[model samples]
Target: MDTNTLMRTLDGTLTCTTLYGHKYRSAITGQDRMPMALEGLTRGKSLWIDSLVHFTCPLTPQQETQHLSRTPVPGSVCLHTPEETVTLHERGADVSFSEHDVPEDSFLSYRPRLLMAVTNITITANEWQHTEEWQLDLEEI
Candidate 1:
């Protein structure tokens, strides 16, 4: 277990834990005024709150391949992080996020993925316990 507390209930009873991931949900509201127009479509529109995820973890080469396969090539991927689970579409559509970058030891921003139907598979290869570890810098996708 990661032992990092991600979320808690209002009463401080429920808690969410994770090893190396964080979730952030942001909402942007837009309102346009048109006195001449009688249509209700242009008055104000509410948008779906988008999630910005920053995920970092270490895995073996085989595990890396599995994650790549899990990600949708042309579509969105539903992310199940330690904070929360949400169905998200990949914003950048880049498939090489986990290939080169490594995250430094810093503060992880936590805010808030996936449906209950599909379970996420996570494979972590810790450097202290495994012979090989592949560090990744997963962005919003």
Candidate 2:
């Protein structure tokens, strides 16, 4: 797996726009297209998306102290703002296959290869309030 440090800074409440794509093929038919959707998040939203979407919010001050002393698991990070929690986990293997090589037997059987490079992120109101932009770095740790 490729290793790189990522930095994300959240100075204030921010919104992010994302895009998605799909494909289909048949002997008599061809591929199709679907429109993308707009997913919303606040200062403290954390999420993971595969076929479906999974979200996690930040722990409360008490919960933070209890759960997040050093490193955090996937569920422990919480988003404290008014926005919905959202996370995106990209499977590089699933999306890496060639269109022609995809099996024709099952439409739903294809599971995209995803790489969990950065698994967890925790955001604080103070961090968002003081910073203008959020940054994340992935370094050898």
RMSD of 1: 20.4
- Which pairs clash inside model 1? 76-89, 84-113, 85-113, 85-114, 86-113, 86-114
Candidate 2 per-residue lDDT, tens place, 16-73, comes to: 3322332211111112232112145332333332322222323332221222112232
> How many clashing residue pairs are found in candidate 1?
6
Candidate models: Cα lDDT each: 0.32, 0.26
The ten-residue window of minimal lDDT in model 2 covers 22-31
Candidate 2 error regions (>4 Å): 1-52, 65-78, 83-141
- Model 1 lowest lDDT segment of ten: 110-119
- Estimate TM-scores for all models: 0.20, 0.15
Best by TM-score: 1
Per-model root-mean-square deviation over C-alphas: 20.4, 23.6
Q: What TM value does model 1 have?
A: 0.20
Model 1: residue 106 alpha-carbon error in angstroms: 16
